[model samples]
Target: MAAIHLPRTIRIGGGVLDELPEVLAAAGLSRPLIVTDAWMQSSGLLARVEALLGGAGIAARAFTGVVPDPTVTSIDAGCAVLAEGEHDCVIGLGGGSPIDSAKMIAVRRDRTIPELKAPHQEDSPGLPIIAIPTTAGTGSEATRFTVITDAETDEKMLCAGLAYLPLIALVDYELTLSKPPRLTADTGIDSLVHAVEAYVSKRANPFADSMALSAMRLIWPNLPRACADPQDRSARAALMLGALQAGIAFSNSSVALVHGMSRPIGAHFHVSHGLSNAMLMPAITQWSAPAALPRYAQCARAMGLADDSEADQSAVGALVEALHRINADLAVPSPRAYGIERERWEALIPLMAQQALGSGSPANNPRLAEAGEIEALYRQVWH
Candidate 1:
């Protein structure tokens, strides 16, 4: 038996952001602290959103100090702001970084990273969160997971539990309209990885399977189209919905090795999360395919890379090829190509492998990996 979890409220589509005030009112939320990055702050999107909230008679303040690959330090700053403002609610108003920062700020209760990392984190759910994502990637608006980096250890901590789940998600595809081409590619691949990993994870169940398949079906054909032409409204909407559905699926069923392995790279290399996942996808899938041939075939069919008439083994091969093609088209570089020096990468390999194992996500992989195997896989992705 398995349990399912999700945000209670999910408002989707373009121009749906105009309804944020009523959504907040229905939840009895007032005085929201909008956590976001500097880009949103300078771009006037923050001010515009503030105007909308004010017009709705809601009192909200913006906390725009967050940064990419958010650190414990950043979360502490957000927490201080939240504490000083005496906010009654939290609104994660950017991409994954700010949303994750918001989640940590909401869930922290004098708990250190070690304490929170424990499988059993006993604490109140903290402030109610209403997430509004500007990017089509991360699906952070709808998930129970948040990644925060530990400045001291340089480790990306993957925190899970219902406490981090947002109470509401307001997804407006219009927000993603201005995202550049590279971002569109990276985030799109990340969403695809989420759906595929969830569908094949050890904890997967029928309900999760349905969501994962749906996400794959939506993301596959449309991600490239959206990447090529940012003005494509329908493609953008489909990608947003796909990212959300993938977030929901992975939240319930959990992610496997690709995520487990990808995190350390993001933490150590300062590489973006989605690009890290994209970098590892092909090699990891090729190595893990034998353990779940049929499932990989299903993913191939979902991605439209293989058909029902294909043999399972051939379908798996096609899936691996497709992942490579996507990465190439997206211009995702390998660790070496991305400019991580060989000496530094060599030194970090052991720690990266250890961190991935400690994350506990790799344990859910269809074919469980030993640390040695993980180290080898890391080497494979380097060049």
Candidate 2:
């Protein structure tokens, strides 16, 4: 049997933020907790959101301390605010961190103890959540997964369940207009990896495959343009939509090697999720391609690197080269170049590989890799 899940309502366009009141009304939520980050608070985006909600006579409380790679402590803190305010809904109004934090907060709101916050343990229905993504990465707005760091163990907990999916998603491309070039590139590449991994996953289904292919086609051509010129609304729009589509695809089908490997790096080294994904993407793809040639070739064609006459292997090569070119154009720095010491990175390889395996994402890959293969891939990225 095939199971596909998505949000009930998705509002997208240039000024979709204006529709939040009506969305909340339809959902019967009048008081909401606005979860965001300090950056968004400082930039007045949170205020803008509050004003819009206030204009519609909706009451909201703001909790704006979510950090990148949201930790369990952070979720608990936000949940405290939610409990105190007696919020009926949650508006996640930033990038991945805040959106992810919001999901967890909603899930854990009824829990009086912290021990019950583990994945699949909290069985209560979460409050209604409306995700507003300011960045076109992570697609947390559309996904059912919420990654949070375990404060005690310093391990990233991949908490996932249908209850975590947002009730509504508001994707407005204008919110991403201020993203710098490097962010555009990193997040755009992250979205691309999500789509490709979803397509090549052992769990890939007909529905996810369609969404993944469509996301890749939309993102590949427009990411560079968006990176080169952040003011290009059309390019930003395509990238935003592509990221959300890829999120929905992977949320149902699962993310494979790259994400499995990427999460540990973020947990241990404090690297951004997208950047860590960027670091391992090329190497992981190269390693996994042979096991899923037809899917890789399909991805190549979607990226416009394949012709009917070209061999599948040749097209895969072209695809890899094209990715390298995009990395160069975007100035994606290698892990070594990004300044992690050789000895330290080498020391953590075994542990990172173990954590990656424990995350269960690699099991979903078309080519399920053992710990040794993951370690080898990590070594390959060091150089």
Candidate 3:
């Protein structure tokens, strides 16, 4: 049996943010809590959204405190805002942090204690959520996963369930026009990893495979152009659409080795999620390639590195080389180069390996890694 799920409504284009009021009204939501970050708030994007909502006669309250790598404390704060405002819906209006924070807010709205938030816990439909993504990475707008930090432990909690998927997703490429080159590159690579991991996951089905392949084709070619010129609307649009598709693919299927290994680095070292993924991507792919040759070959073809006539192993090798090239071209740095202390990184290897295993993601990989193997891969990336 094959199961594929996606958001009920997705609006995409250059100016689709204008459809917010109509979209919300059609869904029977009136009052909305706008979840965003201080940067977007300071940049006036939040106010612009408010103005657009006001013009369409929808009332909204803004909570602009979500930080990067959203912590449980941040979610708690946003939920407080939602409660006081008595919002009927939530509008997540920034990148992954705000969107992930908003998802948790929706889940925690009725809960009294914040610590009780778990992936498996059920919440009464608190409020409908509309995810409006400003960046093309993380794909939190389309996925059911929301990574929240345990502030006390400094560990990332990868909570996921059906409830986290947005009721609607509004993807406007225009919003990403101002994204700097580093962010564009990192996030674009993150999207690529999502598609690649989904395609090679044990849970992958025919439906997700199609989406994953299409997403790779869309993202691989346009990422460099978008990075070089942030104002390239067409490239930006392609990347955004690719990211959305990759989110749906991974949401229904799963993300394998790269994501499983990437989270702990983010939690322990405070590295950005996409950059961590990029740092570990080449090594992880090389490690897992022997297990899923045909699928990796398809990925190579999608990235335009090979064709049907090429040997599967050769094509997979090409894919890995291409990823390394992308990393070098985009200036993706190694952990050592990114400034993690060598001794400290080695000390945490065992704990990070255990945490990665505990997340239940490595088991979904086409070739599952034992603790020792996962530890070795971490060491391999040290340089």
Worst 10 residues of 1 by lDDT: 114-123
- Which candidate do you rate higher for lDDT, 2 or 3? 3
Count of clashing residue pairs in every prediction: 0, 0, 0
Error of 1 at 345 (Å): 0.6
Tens-place lDDT digits, model 1, residues 258-283: 99999999988899999999999999
Instruction: Please rank every candidate by lDDT, starting with the best.
Output: 1, 3, 2
Note the residue pairs that clash in candidate 3.
none
Candidate 1 vs 3: which has more TM-score = 1
The TM-scores, one per candidate, come to 0.98, 0.96, 0.97
lDDT of 2 by residue, 195-295 (tens): 99999999899999998999999999999899888999999999999999999999989898899889888888888888888888877887889999989
Displacement of residue 118 (Cα, Å) in model 2 is 8.1
After superposition on all CA atoms, what RMSD does each candidate show versus the true structure?
A: 1.1, 1.7, 1.5
Better-scoring candidate (lDDT), 1 or 2: 1
Positional deviation of residue 329's Cα in model 2 after best superposition, in angstroms: 1.8
lDDT of each: 0.89, 0.87, 0.89
Model 1 regions lying over 4 Å from their true place = none
